[model samples]
Target: MEPIVILTLLAAMIILLLILGAPFKSFKWIGTGAVRLLIGALFLFFLNTFGGIFEYHLPINLFTASVSGFLGVPGIVALIFLDMMVVN
Candidate 1:
């Protein structure tokens, strides 16, 4: 797309959002979910890093991250158990 066209569309979107007001609830939900996902990723990273000595690992992806993020430690344990069952 042309730069001018993109700029115009961006400006229009900003104006529309400003006129309608931002959705605080949606933003809060999204922000919370994003933070959880980040935390989940960190959990997995540490798990993999430390668990490496024990020869354990779990793939870091959306579903796993969501499960771990929303469910916390239990989620990671569940993933490990599930991986064991599936892989073996």
Candidate 2:
């Protein structure tokens, strides 16, 4: 399948999750809006490189560490997933 198609599907899935409000509570610490997204992207990047792949893959410290004081998880998840798709 084309990369674009895969991306579209991924986007659709994320949107569906948002609409369904599935376990978003875990992400509440992320705060609200674009700032959260920006941080998530930075976090996702540093997480893998600075902390290593295992660290990034695991959630032991991700929730507390990534949230950075407070909004939503989608922005973070979106940033991470978007970078993953684009980078790899």
Model number with the top lDDT: 1
Tell me the tens digit of each residue's lDDT in model 1 across 3-85.
45644664565455556554687676665676677667767877887899999889889999889989999999999999999
Looking at candidate 1, the ten consecutive residues that score lowest on lDDT are 13-22
Off by over 4 Å in 1: 1-23
Judge candidate 2 at residue 29 and give its lDDT: 46
| Poorly placed runs, candidate 2 (over 4 Å) | 23-88
Which lDDT tens digits does candidate 2 get at residues 36-59? Answer: 443444444445555574545423
Alpha-carbon lDDT of model 2: 0.47
Query: What TM-score, computed on C-alpha atoms, does each candidate reach?
Result: 0.71, 0.28
Please report the TM-score between candidate 1 and the true structure: 0.71
